[model samples]
Target: MVWGLTPLFVHQRILPVECWYPFDEKRKYVYETLYFIQILAQGQIGQVFGNGSGVYVVLITLICGQYDILFCSLKNVLYTAEINSGVSAELLRGKQLAVDKEKEELNQYFVSKETFENLDNLDQRLVKRNLRNATKDALNECIRHHQGIVKVCTLLEEFYNPFCLVKSLQMTVQLCFLVFVSVNTTASVLKSLNLAQYLFMTLCELFIFTYLGQVLKVQSLKTADALFRCDWYLLDLDIRKNLLIFLPIAIRPVQMTSAKFSGMDTQRLRAILTQAFSFFTLLQSLT
Candidate 1:
């Protein structure tokens, strides 16, 4: 039952890694999780780690689901790092190119009428004129890269929106069940690693998704500052106006959520913990 439903809930990501980062697009992927329940769907259901019911039927899904979310979070963190490096590099490179072009332009126009005649020889003036003629370029690579980063964030929100919703629903039901088992079969539940493992896996899975989204949001906010530091004033007037488009995006910020319920972050994680305990308490009181 869990096997078939996993993929429907998973949705992977919208744009593959290649679409977001050049390095990721170029590098071949290996040892990556294809979906949430690959092993179980491969006829390993009754035989996860060569164990049966109290283990196989339960632990495999819990552990695999936990692992899937964790792996996704780790990849997201790495991807964000690549994005930061790319953004920084492109911003600096474009600024330097702008500076070089500015120097060449300065050669054509007098820095000041007094300073131009003070040059020792024509060769000094010639270098600036020749370099200006040579450095003729109009480009803003940073904007394109920022667009890519924004796309990644957009896709991430799309991919994980459904994921967090389904998982929240799944966890609510799963935790309620765990609370029941822990209440009614306290000794048996304590004795079995499988049962305890399920609880641990639930918390860990929730932590990874919420925390990763939170970090992504935090980093996305930093891009605004990165954009400001990119020497936009030095860019051509047209280019500077075009660069202003990023300002709105940065100010509003990028974020992911659990079905629009809340921002996925440490606060969300804390709320989940509180809800779990509250659920456990409500369950205990009823019993």
Candidate 2:
């Protein structure tokens, strides 16, 4: 904003933006009128993009947070499996360790630890059953949360598709124009500074979108890893089966698209910059 209004303090008569005016702007009244009009237009455009992008960033951040929370839930589901039973994870781990040590000493233990514990009247089946049930419930909840995340992403893509598409389409041209103007020797120092600021702001806006999208994609892909690390092997057949079924779905990362054409990620920024540079070269060659 400060850059947009820097012309007011400069000695030379320069408008905030370089555009063809309908009337001659040399007259005092005409210059002042157009100056304020340009400032007003710039402010309005800034307000629209600022508010809209702020909301869009907030939503994406929230989804990333949800993914973080879901990961924690999955990793802890095994440790927290105490549904309808007094058996704690600490006790379960202790029992397993003791049985393992005893089997090593005997050197003739062929049966699984749980079976041996059951023979010892430790009620291992009851604990295993409770753990299995708790794991099943937690898996179901995680599946629901995953579904919700996918649904919200789909809705966001639909709602912001047009806005993102327009911004992406114009970014190359905007960058080229800003770069050309800022580097032009004939342009005033203040105007060049303003164009530089605008160029940085535009790049920052695009970075926010692509960076957030990358974060979302990376976090979503980590869900499968979280599931694997949650000790699924210790779970019963049904619970392990559930994890197997979910693994494939979780492996496929979520993505956001602009107008369902371009994927939103850091790569998009690179592609856009490449196109802008190519066009800028052509423009320079033409002149």
Candidate 3:
């Protein structure tokens, strides 16, 4: 709002935007009216940016939150399956301890009497079958969740990719001109401050998008890593086979892009700033 009224402090009549007008703007009443119009238009533009960017950030944040939840879900699926399948951890541990003890005792020409009782107490085959089925079911559920996330991403891409493309193009030009103008000329302190604020705002907006894009990409790719870090080796052969099939698909990273022309990441931000600098350098040389 303060930026929109910058003309008020200039001590001379001016409009927020300079453009060709059909009528004279220097007339006392005409100047006041046009000045009011320009300030109001600028204010409206500010409002759109404030509110629209909030919504944009929220949607992206929600998507990122979902990715986080999916990661936790994938990591815990096996443990959850074991719990749900009523697998007794105590019995498994007892059986393992018995087998180890028996091995040690046999080397000393002694067999422990408790080893036979421990081995007979556990229904190992039934436990294994139940765990396998539970794990398979859990994996299937996780796959469905993954599919849902993919669909949401597709929808987001379709709706926002074009907007991102336009925003990137607009900011590229705006940053280039802003840098050129700021460097090439002298201005009043207030004007310089205003330009700096505008430049900062533009950079901040771009940073948000690129940073979030990078975050989404990282979180999406980590899904596979999370799965791999789980106890897959202990899983049944059939369950491992299912995971082997799903691992490659999970390994593919999700990247947010601008109409498929460019990705929205730190690298993209670097490219944009580089392009803007090149323009600034060229304009400086020409002048």
The candidate that wins on lDDT is 3
Q: What digit string (tens of lDDT, one per residue) describes model 2 on residues 18-63?
A: 7886878868888888888888998998899899899988898888
Q: Which whole-number lDDT from 0 to 100 does residue 39 have in model 2?
A: 87
| Model 2 spans with C-alpha error above 4 angstroms | 18-31, 83-85, 88-129
Query: After superposing candidate 3, which stretches have Cα over 4 Å from the reference?
Result: 87-129
Query: Number of clashing pairs, model 3?
Result: 0
Give a tens-digit lDDT track for model 1, residues 188-221: 3223445567677777667666666665555555
Compared with the true structure, the alpha-carbon lDDT of candidate 3 equals 0.77
Write the candidate numbers in order of decreasing lDDT.
3, 2, 1
Sort by TM-score, top down from the best: 3, 2, 1
Residue 31's lDDT in candidate 2: 85
* lDDT by residue for model 3 (129-150), tens: 4766788888888888888887
Clashing pairs for predicted structure model 2, backbone only? none
Note each model's CA RMSD in angstroms.
Answer: 19.5, 9.6, 11.3
